[model samples]
Target: MDSQADLADILAGEPERIATGFQFTEGPVWHSDGYLLFSDIPANRIVKWTPDGKTETFREPSGNSNGLTYDRAGRLIACEHGNRRVSRTEPDGTITVLAERYNEKRLNSPNDVVVKSDGSIYFTDPPYGVSEAERELDFQGVYRIAPDGTLTLLIDDFDRPNGLAFSPDEKSLYIDDTAHRHVRAFDVLEDGTLANGRILVDMAIDAQGSPDGMKVDTAGNLYVTGAGGTWVVSPSGEHLGTIVTAELPANCAFGDSDNKTLYITARTSVYRVRLKIEGMKTF
Candidate 1:
C-alpha cells in the first residue's frame, strides 16, 4: 500500500461534504443502521447523519464525548471527556460506566478507545479534557478494562496519548502521542498486556498537524489524523501521503454498507469519501 497507485485506488472519488454547521467535531463512527454517528464536542451532542443527507441529534449533553466505537456485541462504547470516564450504551438504552478510576484516583480524561476480540477494552487517558488543578492522576496513562470489570494500567509514560487501534491480526496495538507527534506499536501478549513497544512513525517536527485519531484498513494501512490532513502510512511506517480535506480533521472512521466510505470529523463539519478498500471488521 505504499505506491501512488495503491493510494489512488483507495480514494474512490472527491470527498463530499455531507454535513456542516457544527462547533468542534470528532469521533466519527459508522453504524450498521445506515447512519454515521459523530461527536460535536462543543455542542455536547452526538449527531447522526445518513447517506441521503439527513442529519439529526442522536444524543444531547453527551458528556462532551470525543471518541466512539461499537463493541463486538454492537454496543456503542464512548470516551466521555467531560465526565472523565468511558461508557457503554446497552441494548436497553441504558448507559453503563465501564471505568472511571484506578487505584482510588480519578482518571484525568478518557480520550479514545478500542475493544479486543476477547471482550477486553483499551483506552487512552490524557489531561486534555480537564484543567491541571482539577486532575487527580499525576501522569497520563493507557489502560485496559477486562471482561470481568477489572481495570489494569498498561502504560503510563506518555506525555499525551490520544488515538489507538489494533492491527489487522490483533497481535499488535498502535497508539499515538499527541504531544510527541509520533505513533508507537506494542506487541499484544497472550494475556492482553502490551510489550515490545517501538516507534512506528514520527510526524516530523515541522509537520502540519499533531497526531490525534487513527484507523487501519483490512490491508493494515494506517490512516492517522495529523499535520495537514489524514496521513496514510504503511504498516511499517512509510509515509504514503495524505487525504486532504477542507477543514483540519480531528478524527475519522470507516462507514457505509461496504465499510468503504471514510467519514471524517473535521473542525466544523463532517465529510466523507468513498474508498476502494474495506475497513478492518471489528466483529
Candidate 2:
C-alpha cells in the first residue's frame, strides 16, 4: 500500500475546492448533528460550513483557536492559542476551561487534541501560540486528561507536539511533531499512558511544510497534513501518496454522510475529496 495505485484505490476522486477566503484555516471536525467546523486562526473564529455550501461563523473571539474536536457527548473541544488553553463548549454553549496550567505553571499553548474511547482527553502542548518571553513550560509535551479530570504529562520530549489521533482499535496513538517534521507512534497502556515511542513517518522526504494535524482511516492509514498537501501513509510507515490541494493544507478530517469524504483545511480555503474507504470515526 505504498504506491500511487494503492492511493487510487482509496481516493475516489481528486481534491475539489468547497469553500475559500479564510485567514489561515486549520482544525477541521464534523459534527454528528451535521455541518463542518474549522478554525480561522488569524480571524479568531470557528467557521461552519453546511452541506448546502453555505458558510457562517460558529464562534467569534475564538481565543485564536487552532485545533478542534468533538467529545463523546457532542460537546466541542478546542485548543485556543491566544488564550493558551484547551476548552470545551457545553451543550448550552457555555465555555468551560479544560486545561490551562500544569504543575502550577501555565502551559505554553495547547495545540491539538483527541478523545480516547474511555472518555479521557489527550492533547499536545506546544509553544507555537505563545512567545518565548511568555512561555511557562520548558518542553513541549503530550498530555492526557483522565475521566475524573486529572491532567498528567505523558510525553515531554517532543520538539513541538501537534496533531494526534488513535488507531481504529485504540491500541495505538499517533502524534506528530511539527518542529521535527515526523510522526510518532506509541503503545497506549492500560492506564491511558503511552509507551514504546517510535518514529512512524518522516516528512523530510516530502516537499516543504511541516506536519501539523492528521487523521486516521478505518484501515489505520494516516492522512497527515504536511509538505505538499495531505499525505496518505500506510500503517507500516510507507508513504503511499499525497493529496494536493489549491493551497497548502494544515489539517484534514473525514466527514459527510458515510464518512467517505476527506475535508482539508488549507491556508485560506477548504477542500474535500471522496474516498472509497471510510474514515475512522472516534465517536
Candidate 3:
C-alpha cells in the first residue's frame, strides 16, 4: 500500500502541465503518432498536445466529443454527445457518423466509449448532456456499434452507465454506475452480450463522492476516478488505496512517453505521475 506521504507526493509537487487556457476538458486519448488528443467540452473543440508540450487545434466544433479511442486502422473514434451520435475521424480528416439512433428513436447522448480488438465500438449513453425531459431513450443503456455499422444494445438496466472498460482478457466488462454509487462487473458472452452482473465495489457515496471514469492497468488493476481522488482496486476488487489529487479529478488515463505515467485530469489541470506499473492501453 502506498502511504499517505507517498500519495501526497503523487498529487502534489512539480507536475507535468501539457497545456492550459481551456474552458473545460474531458476524454483524453494518447496518439502514438507523437501527440495527445482530448476534448475541450465547453469550447466545443478537440485539442492536440505534442510530446514537447506544444498545443494545437485538432478539430473545431467537434460536436461535443467526449470519450475517444483509435480503431485497429488507427482512425480516431469519438463519442459526440451534442450530436447524439458516435463518429470516426478518418485519416483524410473527414468525420463519419457511426451510430445515431436505436429503432428510429434518437439516442440521448453518447458519453464514454471503448473499442474492442474486433473493431466494435462500445459506449455508454447517459442523459447528462441533455435536459431530463428531452431524453427520448427510456433508459441509459450500453450500446455496441458493430464493425458493419449495426447498433446493438448490450444492457439497458444500469441506472447510469458512466465509465466502461473491458477486462484484460476481454471476458469481463466493468461499468461504473454513478447514481448507484458502485462499479458493476458483467460476464462478456461469446456474442458480445453481458450477463451475470454483480457489484464489484460498493463505494461510500459520501466519502468517494461518485465513480466517474476508469481504466485497467496491464496487471488488471482498475484505476477509477472519484471525487476524493483516484482509487486503485486490485484485480480481485480489493480497495488497494487512493491516489490523491490536487483538485477534483474528472478522468484519468495511463499515458506517457513510455506508457508508464498515470496522466490525470483534475478539474482544470492535467497532471502525471510515474507509475511502477504501465497501463494496458497506449493512452
Please provide, for model 3 over 146-201, each residue's C-alpha lDDT reduced to its tens digit, 9 standing for 90 to 100.
Answer: 88888999889887688788888989889988888788999988888889999998
Ranked by lDDT, the better of candidates 2 and 3 is: 2
lDDT of each: 0.90, 0.91, 0.78
- For model 2, state the Cα shift of residue 247 in Å: 0.9
Q: Once superposed on the true structure, which residue ranges of model 3 sit more than 4 Å away at CA?
A: 1-17
TM-score of 3: 0.92
Our model 3 lands, by Cα RMSD against the true structure, at 2.6
Please give, for residues 1-283, the per-residue lDDT of candidate 2 as tens digits: 3333457788999889999999899999998767999999999999999999999998999999988998888889999988999899998989999899999899988989999878899999999889999988889989999988899999999998999999999999999989899999999999999999999989985477999899999998999998877889889888898888879899999998889999999999999999999998746
Clashing pairs in 1: 208-227, 209-227
Candidate with maximal TM-score: 2
Candidate closest to the true structure, highest lDDT: 2
Give per-model TM-scores.
Answer: 0.96, 0.97, 0.92
- List, in order, the clash count of every candidate structure: 2, 0, 0
- For residues 98-175, what per-residue lDDT tens digits would candidate 1 score against the true structure? 999989999998999999988999999999999999999999999999999899999999989999999999999999
**Judged by TM-score relative to the true structure, which candidate is superior, 1 or 3?**
1
